[model samples]
Target: MEKIAAIIGGGVIGGGWAARFALMGWQVRVFDPDPEAERKIGEVMANAERALPMLYESPMPKRGEITFHDTIAEAVVGATYVQESVPERLEIKQKVYAELQKHVAENAVLASSTSGFKPSELQEGAARPQQILVAHPFNPVYLLPLAEVVPGQASLEVIEKASETLRDIGMYPLHIKAEIDAHVADRLLEAVWREALWLIKDGICTTEELDDAIRYGFGLRWAQMGLFETYRIAGGEAGMKHFMAQFGPALKWPWTKLMDVPEFNNDLVDLIAGQSDDQSGHMSIRELERLRDNNLVAMMRALKGQEAAAGKLIRDHDARLRGPLADEVPLVTVRRTVPVDWVDVNGHMNEGRYGQVFSDASEELMAHVGADRAYIDAGNSYFTAETNIKYLDETLVGEEFFVETRVALGEGKKLRLLHEMKRASDGAVLSSCDQFLLHVSLETRKSCPPLPDVLAAVEALADKHAG
Candidate 1:
């Protein structure tokens, strides 16, 4: 059965939701009164189609269909999930909900993208209020995993179902127990935003300078370890308590005008807007978004190597996406899309990435023959002795490719693999790798015969591929 998702507004956030759900194999129905809604959402989808798959080594689910409808009722007809991204005004949201309830299924999970409004506030004077909840997501929803889920009046079943749906589409749902204005992340952001405004107003720092201070400093730390963990590290050998004792008193110092409000006058707006324009006015919004996406992909991919933070989420999702290898003559060892970050200045997949693909294919083959992670951990494993790679064709970013491997030799203490990488769409051979490896005993760090089971499995594969 195909999952269906209804998006009530086709703005940036809504379009992102649509793209994410669709990319995750959910049929998306969209309704927005804007005449250019389709074009806007189309542009968002274009960016998403290119960027989202880069975060994973496995190929993404086949993209589901996206359709625009004239009315909310049409959009929600068969939807199991409805995401409302209309304007922030409470009255407007209430009206949309009222109309949506008329057509939406009783069991459907209705979520709002409002940043400030509590689920309790949105549920007032609504039909089946228990079905509604706040599922606030960050911008570029296709990439970011965080979705602050505020259950409010919603039932436990509904909340569970909503969380399951979010995780199914690769989102991390942080359940907020109590309904509060602006939720958790934004509340913290508000403090920083308030201080930033004051800084600009008081001539302490220009917008660019303030941004530079963050991007070149704490922003990098925050991306991985976040606030308290980073601060704990700052404490040195004593840990968090020592750091808190030293810096806690500074909170009382009049270093920030956080409680003070910068007047929302035209002069203030001009001052901030002029500085921002001077900083990044040269590039169009789409260009900026692409640049941001590229940077995020690079950073997150780095995190993936470390298996921390967002990278862990990505790795887990990749594991879920990966299926068992099928029984074939030349075992299909690797099937994945070339990520954006894999491409170098040459505008094609880098030579280094080809090495990675072959190495991964080799790992897959090793796993198949019972010499997997556990086998390696047990002090018995195959170590690559030598490899020769021939790059026969150009491979570009977003290209779907698979590697077929054959066991050229599998005997006492020696294993050789012949791998051919081919483009999925055309079956064109992109590259080939001939790898020679030796079974080694980790304790002695010398070539050794594999354990009985592993040796038998490898020999069997070699015999099968011998034809």
Candidate 2:
């Protein structure tokens, strides 16, 4: 059966949710009363298509169907998942859910994108209330991994099913144990907002300055270690408990005005917006979002290399994405869309990045030859002794590309590989890399003969890929 998702209200969150599922090969139907619904969703999907694939190292599945519908009933008729991103008002959501409950299939998991309203609040006065849960996702949901799975008086089965569905589409479903007004993430966000508002209202910092403090400092640490872990690292030799002991006394200090909220007056809003524009007035909002996405993709991928935080999630998902390659043609070692972050000031992929790209491709070939992570863990693996690269053409961001690789030689302890990087659009050879490698035993840190099984697999591949 084809996996289908029905999205209620084609707003930013709804459109993003649709993009996430649709990009993962799920047929998505969206319903909204607005005439501009399709256009809005198309815009969101365009942004999603450009950025989401860049986050993955493996070839993505084919993009799926995205159809806009006129009515909720029509949209939900056969959908396996129904996500409601209606306006934040409880009455509006309740009215929509009442109608939604009437049409959605019994097996479909019903979800809400409400950030403030608890699942219990949304569950009241609704038919099959147990089916509805607060499935809140952050803005730009296509890139971010978190999807807060807030359960109400719902069955554990539905929540578990929802969790599976979210993970299938590359989202981290954080199950909130006890439901409250805003749930976990937003409450933390609210605390930060209060402090930021105070800073702005007191003229202590401009909006740009406030943002700079985050992006340049704690944000980097928070991206990987988070608050607790970052604090734990700060403890030096003693660790988290010692750090808490040293910092606990400061908790009583009046360091922040968390209890107070500044009025979101028009002047304050204007002041903040004016400062923001002055800071990044050179780029359009779309251009800014692209920049932001590129930075995030780069940061996340860097973390992935270290197997930390959100990077680990991407790695885990990428591992599941791996499958056996076709037995025809050159082995497709690296197939991916060029991420925006790879582009340098010259408007092409950086020279250093090309090396990383080829290395990744070579790693894929190694894994295919039975010299994968396990082989490395077992203290034996291939190490590139030398690489000769020729860049035939410049590659830009979001360009589809693949590497054709073949084993040129596989002897007792020596291996040689050939790689050709081609642009998908024109089949142009953008680059080529010829790598010389040696199997090494990690325990002794010395050249060693390859394992018998790995050598056999390598020789088989070499024969098949022979000229």
Candidate 3:
């Protein structure tokens, strides 16, 4: 059965939540009064469609339906999850929650996308307050993996379920044991933001320089290793304790205005905004979003290989989502829409990536017949001896396609495979590959026959294909 996610606002965060849920195969109902909600949400989805899939090799679930509802009741009617992304005002949020109880099921998890508002504050004066928890997601929710799950007067069950649900959909849910003012990541962000404001207010550094300090400095390490862990490595073999001990005195240093506020006067505001403009004002907002998404995709892909931090979430979930399969028909081994990150300077799927696609399909075929990870671990695996790829048509970003693979031959020590990469919209062959592999014993590092069971499975698939 298809799942339904009710989104109660259509602004950036709400729209982001919608995109995240919808892309994860949950039919999403969005309720908002803004006339421009669809256009704005569409823009967010466009960016998401290009970026999210690049993080995984396996096929994503089929995209679910998105409907803009006229009312909150209409939206939450059969929703399994109701996410409120309205403005941060308490009264406004409570009113929506009050109306929500009448339509949404008691079992449905109610989540708020409020960045700063604690779950307690959000649930205050609201009906069925225990159901409302803060599932605060970062901006560009589809691309970013972190979703802070903060419970109010809710059950641990709710928190666990919410966390698991978010994890299943490629998010890293950080559970807050105590309901603080701001959730974990945001609290750290606030400290940094406060100091940055003071710096700009005092003309200590321009907005660009401050940004460079982050992006060009510890930001890269912090992306995967995080603060204390990076510092632990800095401490050498002494570890986190030694690092903390060495730097503990700096906590009281008067270096940062972390607790102080810069008055939001017109002069400071103008200086910050003007400097920000001079730094990145040339690019439009959409262009900037694309740029950000591209950088994030590249960085995340690098991390995925290392199974580090958020990339590890993608890696783990992808493993659970896939397993060995045996198929006869040119099996649809790869089904995915092209990601913008796949595009090259010529504005199409880069030629090298086509080779990657073919390689992935061949790997999938290898797995299908039990010649997978365990087989490789057992010191016997297929080594590609030859491959021929022919690109028939130009493939572009966001274009849905599938690779239908067939085992042409499955002899004792060798196998031959053919993969037809076709566009999903129309059965047009985008590319084709013929791959020949020689099974080898890892111990001997020479040509050898696959194990009996793997050999049987391969021959079975080849026989089925031939039939």
Candidate 4:
């Protein structure tokens, strides 16, 4: 059966949730009270159109259609998952939950994208609390894969099932042992945010300076390895125990007030927002989000090559969120054995030249999309944002091999591509490269929606592999 997910609210967070599930190939139905929901959701989707494909090297899954619903009940009809992102008011949330319980399918999991409220509060009067839990996602849900699942007295089996479902969609679901306000990740972030506020209020640093310290230092470490792992590494040859023992004495320093209360006064808010304005100068929020996602795509791509946790996330994402399949896009013929130069010192195919074969295949894809030299001359081109490869067999010099490119997902401004590298002689599988690329406007250095003809071609490619 085809998996489907429904989104309610259609605000920034709702739009992100819609894009996240939709890009992963789930049929999505969105319902929102906002009269201008379409325009706002369109903006959010536009950003995702460019960012989602760049998250991996391979093609993404064929995106399901996004259907707009006039009411919440209409949206949840046959959904496997229901993500609620309505306004934060408790009574409003309660009302929405009541309505959702009536319409959402019995077997479907219901998740709330509430960051501040506990699941217990949202599920207080829920008819199916066991299936209702928190699947809180960070703001830019399409890009960030972390999904903190906080179950509210829900059955363990239900929680696990929900987590597994989320994992299938390329998310890292951290199941909290017990229900708590804000849960794990948000609590940790709150601590840091509180401290940052104190530092700013005390005139210790500007907003930009605080951001610099985090991003340039610990942020880089945290990307591939979490805080605990980094600390364990810092402990050196002695390991975590010995390292902690040696550095335990420094804990007594009066450097931080971990328990200090923070006052969210208007003056403080104005000061911070003003400082932020000065730091960013004139870029709109959309522009900043785009820039941030591009950097994240690049960073995550590098991590994928190293086979790190983040890299594994990208792989899981590719396997689940496949792009439009290029089965009908007649396979290009390559009849040569692997050249000696193609095999690096490691006795496997080098990473760089995987592009050469893929690039040759991409020519067909570009032509299929109407992006020929004329398109390039018109200031449009495709840029590789990310790629992940799995080496299954070692190919030595003179080992016959051939590669085939297939469209795994195609939509909006991005495309997910999958390539199979196999030995030509015995037909042994060699490797696979999964990539995400953006259809970019060279002049703007930003993504532009594919033209109608190009979009039509993409739809044809996607349709040929719909099964």
Candidate 5:
């Protein structure tokens, strides 16, 4: 049975939720009175379709259907999950919940995307308060992973299920034990916002300068290590405790006016808006979104190499999505879309990426022949001795491609293989590689013979491919 997710609002956040669910192979039902909801959601989906799949080495699941409904009942009828992304008004949300509770499944996770309201506040006057929880996510919800899940009185089973569902769609569901107004991230953001406003109003820095301070410096660090971890590195040999002790005195300094509220006057708005316009107002919102998405994809892909933070989540999800190697003579391996990061200034895949793809193909071949991770961990593994690659044609970003590997020779410590990469759409040969590898003992770091079982499996594969 196909999984179904109902989105109660089709604004930016709701459309993002729809895109994420649909892209992850969940049929989406959206309820929104806005006549432009379909067009808005369609734009979000287009951006999602281009960006999300580039984060993985494997193809994403076939996109599920997205249907817009006029009534809440129609949207939530068979949905196992319902995400509420309506207006922030408490009365409006409560009214929607009342109508939703009447039609949605008893077990459906009715989650709100409210950044300010606590789950307890959202649950007020609901027929089933236990069914509602706070699952607040960041902007560009399809790309970013964090989802703050605050369960006020929701059932434990419901929370677990919601977390699992979020994980399935590549989101990190941060469980907040105590329901607070504006859980975790937003609170930290509010502090920064307050300080930034003060800085702008006091004529210290323009909006562009404040943004530059973040993007050019600490923002990069925060992307991977986050606040405490990044600060711990500043402690030198002593770590977080020492760092905290050293900087703890600075907390009393009047450097920041976080407690002060800026007057919500038009002048302040004009100041910020005018400066922001001067900064990056030349590009359309869609253009800026695409630019942001591309930058995020590049950064995340770099992090994936180190298997750190959001990159680790992506790596784990990719492992789950990866299928077993197909049983064929020339083994099917390295099937993936050419990611945006793979393309160089020439507007084609960089030459180095070809080596990585062929290397992946060889790794798949290694795993297929019994010399898997376990075998490698047992002080034995293959090391590339030689490679000869012939670039036949240029491959562009977002082009789907696959490689076929054939074991030319597999005897004792020697393994020779051939790889051909072809575009999936037309089956045009893009590149070919001839590779030679040798089994090595990890302890000695020297060439050695493989284990009997591994040697036997490799020999069999080599023979099969020889024909």
Candidate 6:
């Protein structure tokens, strides 16, 4: 059965949550009072259109449709999961839960996206009290995979089921041992903010300087090793215990105000905003968010490719994995974009470009034929017989084109392929080629039939999409 999730609210956070679930292949039903929800969600989905597919090395699962509902009851009726991202007021949450209680099925898991409230408070008026829990996610939920699971006085079985569902949708859910206002992450963040404010009040480093200190220095390490792990490694022959022993004494230093809350005075607010304005300078919030996301995707993918232990574990465990092939057909998996080396003086993709394109297509086809580099070195090779190319559009340097190939004809010793090239940005068809290939025994350098299994696999794919 197709999985369905109902989201209550359509603000930025709700829309992001919707996109995250939808991209992971869950049909989303969203109920929001705002009449402009559809438009707002459309924008959010468009952003995901570019971002989600680029997050992995393999193609992602097909995205599910998003349906808008006028009433909470309509949204919750058949949904297997319900995510309530309503306003923060207690009354509003209670009322939403009351309405949700009457409609959601007994088996459906109910989650509130409240950042501050404990689950007990949100579930106070919930009819199906045990099913309601906190599934608080970080901002830009589509990009960040972390979600804190705060269960009320609910059955352990229900929380386990909810955790499993969250995993299926590609999230890492950390269950809180006991619920508290703001939970674990926010409490850490609050302490950092309080110290940051004190710094600004005391006229220390400017906001941009503070940001640079983190991003350029420790922020890079935080992505792969995290705070404690990085420190553990820094402890030399000793471990976390020794490191803590060495650094614990410094905790008492007046370097930071860990316990004190900054007064929200006029001068402090203005000072913070002024520093923020200086730090941001020209880039708008949307621009900064995009910059952050793009960098995160690139960095994370790079670390994953290196098989860094932490990255590898995260990729293996945190379920909703997606890659390049998810968004479009990967004709070739080149390491980098077409560079100046591949361009002609006319500033267009050079004649050598077609060869590069053909080579990539050939490799992918070989990957299908069991004649890849390793196979070739092991005495199997695929040689091109003839290639007929028709360039339909001019491609410039740095433009990315993915080719899709179909085995037009395949017999005992010869395979015919039809390839179409498309521009990644506009999905414009740029060129096409029809080619014939001969499998050869590399040591003898003569034509041969592909291995029985290879032939069968190729024939199966060719038969299915012989364009």
Write one digit per residue (lDDT tens) for candidate 5, span 109-158: 99999999999988988999999999999989999999999999999989
Deviation in angstroms for 211 in model 4?
Answer: 0.4
Q: Each candidate's TM vs. the true structure?
A: 0.95, 0.93, 0.95, 0.71, 0.96, 0.77
Which lDDT value does model 2 have at 240?
Answer: 89
Q: What is the lDDT of residue 172 in candidate 5?
A: 95
Q: What lDDT does each candidate get?
A: 0.93, 0.89, 0.86, 0.78, 0.94, 0.77
lDDT of 6 by residue, 1-467 (tens): 98999999989889998998898789999999899999998888876655655544334557899999889989986898888898889899989988888888988888988999998998786677898899899877887777899998767877998888887866778999799999998988888788888887888888888888888998788877778899998888988889999999998888887678778999888888887887786897668767766675667556756776334644664333522221222334332234334557888778666766766676666675565668777887778889988888887754555677777777777887777778877878887888888888887899998888778866765776654
Off by more than 4 A, model 6: 57-60, 308-402, 406-419, 424-428, 431-452, 455-467
Enumerate residue pairs that collide in model 1. none
Q: Write the per-residue lDDT of candidate 1 for residues 335-368, one digit (tens) a residue.
A: 8878888899999999998999999999988888
Candidate 3's residue-wise lDDT over 1-467, tens digit each?
A: 77888999999999888898888888999999999999999999988877888777777878888899888888887887888999988888888888898788988899988888888887788777778899999988998988888897977777777887787678888888788887788889988998899988888899999999999999999999998789989888988888889988998989887767988899888998999999999999999998998889888878888998877878887777664553437677887767666789999999899888988887787787778888899898888899999989999977889898888999899899898899988889999999999999999999988889889988988888894
Each prediction's RMSD to truth: 1.7, 2.1, 1.9, 15.7, 1.7, 6.0
Query: For model 6, where is the 10-residue window of minimal lDDT?
Result: 322-331
1 versus 4: better lDDT goes to: 1
Alpha-carbon shift of residue 261 in model 1 (angstroms): 1.0
Please give the distance, in angstroms, between residue 251's alpha carbon in candidate 1 and its true position after superposition.
1.7
- Total clashing pairs for each candidate: 0, 0, 0, 22, 0, 5
Q: After superposition, how far is residue 411 of candidate 6 from its true place, in Å?
A: 11
Regions of model 1 farther than 4 Å from truth: none
Decide which is better by TM-score, 3 or 4. Answer: 3
- Please rank every candidate by lDDT, starting with the best: 5, 1, 2, 3, 4, 6
C-alpha lDDT (0 to 100) for residue 133 of candidate 1:
98
Q: Which residue runs of candidate 3 sit more than 4 Å off their true CA positions?
A: 323-328, 339-344
